[model samples]
Target: YVENNLAQKTIELFNELKNPADVNKTLLNQMKLDDIQSSIPIYLSAIKAVSQIGDYSKAQSIFKQIPDSLLVENQIRSALIDLWGKVGSVVEAKLIFDKIRQPNIIEYTTMGLF
Candidate 1:
């Protein structure tokens, strides 16, 4: 039931961050109590939430926990690219883009379009 808990916690974290009220970073810190290596999906979900709320500092902090190998995965890479672009770091986005191996047409198109 660990997976279930993780999924539920992830949803809670997303909602808390998405609320119009100010975010409580403490909540994020608490979420990090979960096993990060196994909870990459939840962590990534939090990253997306923070990014959407313009909380790049917190999002970057979470992103850093994801290893380069994980970052290379298509789904994660797309999120990171978008995050970097959202934060006005086109150079960083390009750096990640350059490191991608066998980028599909969608990825290529995203790079060109973004």
Candidate 2:
């Protein structure tokens, strides 16, 4: 079924995000974001990996490509915040954190912990 396929693809993408040295851009491009809200987790993981690898520009570009709706999630937004912070963009990170409607304790903790 399409649902099962999407789930599998999402898991694969998540694995790539966690270990971006193994990422295949061609395969990543095949994923259909419109069919999977769970893509947010993979996207966040990719952002973290890219930032850690000193590819902040690429991470920012990918973040920008994601829909505004997708960016609204706490996990995704938290990743963005962290990415911006890693790049020394504290102002942008603060702005994003402030815009979050209902930031949970984890979001607060992440901001402080980092």
Each model's TM-score? 0.66, 0.65
Clash pairs for candidate 1: none
Give every collision pair in model 2: none
Question: Which residue runs does candidate 2 get wrong by more than 4 Å?
Answer: 1-27, 32-38
Worst lDDT run of 10 residues, candidate 1, spans 19-28
lDDT of 1 by residue, 22-114 (tens): 233434455457534434465466557656776657656767766666776787777777777777677877887998878887778767766
The lDDT leader among the candidates is: 2
Cα error of candidate 2 at position 60, Å: 1.5
lDDT for residue 50 in candidate 2, whole number 0-100: 64
**RMSD to true structure for each model, in Å:** 4.1, 4.7
Candidate 2 lDDT (Cα, 0 to 1)? 0.66
lDDT of each: 0.64, 0.66
lDDT of 2 by residue, 39-84 (tens): 6656766676666765656666666667887877878888888877
**Residue 57 error, candidate 2, Å:** 0.9
